[model samples]
Target: MGGYGSGRLHDGRVLCMGGPWVSAIAKDDRFVAGWVTHATRWGIVRGRGNSGGMGGLRMSYRRLYVPGATYFFTVVTYDRRPLFSDPVNVQLLREAFRRVKQHHPFTVEAIVVLPDHIHTLWTLPEGDADFSTRWRLIKTYVSRRCAKTYQPPGSASRQQKSERTVWQRRFWEHLIRNQRDFDNHVAYIHNNPVKHGLATTPEAWPHSSIHRSP
Candidate 1:
């Protein structure tokens, strides 16, 4: 907010806009949510969702303190609402997630890559922190990668200030609190394929948490 741009981030609306969106950021507890934003038509966001501390954290704060527990994260593609990816693309997305993990040294405890979306349970490493920055970096990188792979059905159209298209700009997340939540999220990600009838059993889906979980 203060460091990167100018004054307070303009209040914007969480518009279910037609373009791509972003997922929630889990940076340090103090400012991660500020980064996860929705698209607004008139540059008007939903209120004080715009608060930045101006200066970037000193080098010391870069190694911020984060809990070692598991956290839930969800991100979606640019309105590609249905799970639509070749095995290769899915793998690429997973690789991108892997890159994100390196930054924080976290374990993707669970993950499900739906045709249009993804859910992950990430556990931050000891001492390292800030899930928000991790999500932001992942979204940016994966979206860029997804753009390269996404080929439109027909001739391409020219757009101003933009060339690539792949993912939405925003996402949602939840910090896993207890055993029930963990089990429920695991079930939710695994059952995603079943809910879509993509497979008779969750294990049948190649792109899901079921495969990652032991």
Candidate 2:
């Protein structure tokens, strides 16, 4: 069988895996050396040609992947650009969500669109716990249609991953444990604008579900 050779790591470092070959480059030292040492110490044999990279860098501690479970999410824009400050961009985001819902179909229990980010509560359809796909599609759709201006510079890691500065690399997610959890998240969503000094009250935020809510 063929052997795995030096390949590019997530941080753009060359990972040489033949016989104890190490790079002279100092930049590769941090990630490569640590991973190699860990594998050697633990006797972890990784698959050939596998440079472990899950989209972008690891952000979440542990993602709960229970399909059809209710979840709360906080997603922010790139550089906190306040893209949603304009009403048109806000409408574009809403339209993007609407179109995605038409196809993938998820229940938006609560939602609030802030200038720089969004807070939302969504419940997947039964037997379908794939919120990641939904968020990906939504971001893609909005990026294509939304009003975009100058974007901040993305680092070497983010650029290597082909990620955009349009939105933060990752979002914060919480699985609603029970009724209390759900209620608390909904309240948080409603009050986010006020907390950010964008509004005086939840009812004052026009881009929230509070108006439709009881």
Candidate 3:
């Protein structure tokens, strides 16, 4: 429900929401904080605010949920392992995306798969803004099938949660502000492989969506 805005909190810490995420700092004296609840499956965060806090502090920790928005993302493997160096793993990742898309129905605007990470742009359908669930499904698919092959050891926390050691627990996400931002991120995605010295040119990368671009 929260959306983008900027405001100064009582304690001089600025509260800002750029796209779908919000974070702020407040003085313990001026604000009475409540428990922070995290929806792990969807990666949505909801913060409870006490009655005594300033207006700006009430929702500073909540994520903005805007339907039909485009977002750019960076997903990395655990310990920076080059899991996608193998063609089989790359194919498996592709399958994961394909399967997730069929049910979730989001459009992938651009993507590039590197040895240890992936950069992608996606546009959600109108009346929906649930990219978190889509990502959760995609990551789960690849990890379940490829975890044994890679054999990376998960930490105690991950093992307790029955999570695989193939990927980092979190991914970076940014809502694309406009057409210019979209174009710039697409360029970044294509150029990522060359930046990492894995390819001579963006088009030379076999695992990139640049080949499909006009």
Candidate 4:
């Protein structure tokens, strides 16, 4: 049983419709899972399950596509595995991003890598709003380079599609509303390690783009 409300989205784990952005409560509630025009018009389609629910069951979200627009994303490893804890895994992920960017360009505005998950902001190239493709390539690259055999098994649906079990089949994304939203999400990305007690401060997290700041 669920219904829609003014759900709030933090951590880039949820997407908002009908407005510039949204924040959500953690529980599963009926969400307005639909597409939105860059002109701020919403096409509402109701949906169930939480933001990070099981794959294939939660494709109700028709991602709002906006070319060259800035977006925030959160992606997680299967079963919350600390796949990024190893330096080799981390380096592989960086290489995956670079490989994807070489073909499909996107600007990495802000990024933070945690042991089990990652949050990032990106600006797609002009006339190219296919962030989904970029993510697919990045995940595929990393999974191929750092294949994990003991990972949790994929859902039957995922198997049918030949999807990777290393990463969650779904990711959370939000279109940046404005400069203030962009700034706020970037800070959130930087502060994530501290929030999770992985670091004393954002700068202490070596796996983040905060280290790029001089």
- Provide the TM-score for each candidate, comma-separated: 0.59, 0.67, 0.69, 0.71
In the range 66-104, model 1's lDDT, one tens digit per residue, is 345455666667656442557766767767677765555
Q: In candidate 1, what residue range of length 10 has the lowest lDDT sum?
A: 1-10
Q: Tens-digit lDDT track for model 2 on 1-214? A: 0122333332233333233334324243466446555654565422222111112244434454554566678788877888899898888888888888888987777789998888887776656667888999888777766423635654657656666667876677765544444567768888988988989998999999877623
User: Tens digits of per-residue lDDT for model 3 on 54-155?
Assistant: 111322223334466666778889888999999988998889888887888777767888899888877666567787788899898999988877656546
Report lDDT per candidate. 0.51, 0.65, 0.66, 0.66
Query: Which ranges in model 4 have alpha carbons more than 4 Å from their true place?
Result: 1-61, 153-161
Off by over 4 Å in 3: 1-63, 154-157
Q: Output the TM-score of candidate 3.
A: 0.69
RMSD of 2: 17.1
Pairs clashing within candidate 4: 7-23, 8-23, 8-24, 9-22, 9-23, 9-24
Clashes of 4: 6
Residue by residue across 113-171, what tens digits does model 4's lDDT show? 89999998887765666888899999998887665452565466765676668888778
* Clash count per candidate: 30, 1, 0, 6
Q: Which regions of candidate 1 deviate over 4 angstroms?
A: 1-66, 81-84, 148-165
Evaluation by TM-score, superior candidate among 1 and 2 = 2
Model 2 TM-score (2 dp)? 0.67
Please give the range of 10 consecutive residues that has the lowest summed lDDT in model 4.
1-10
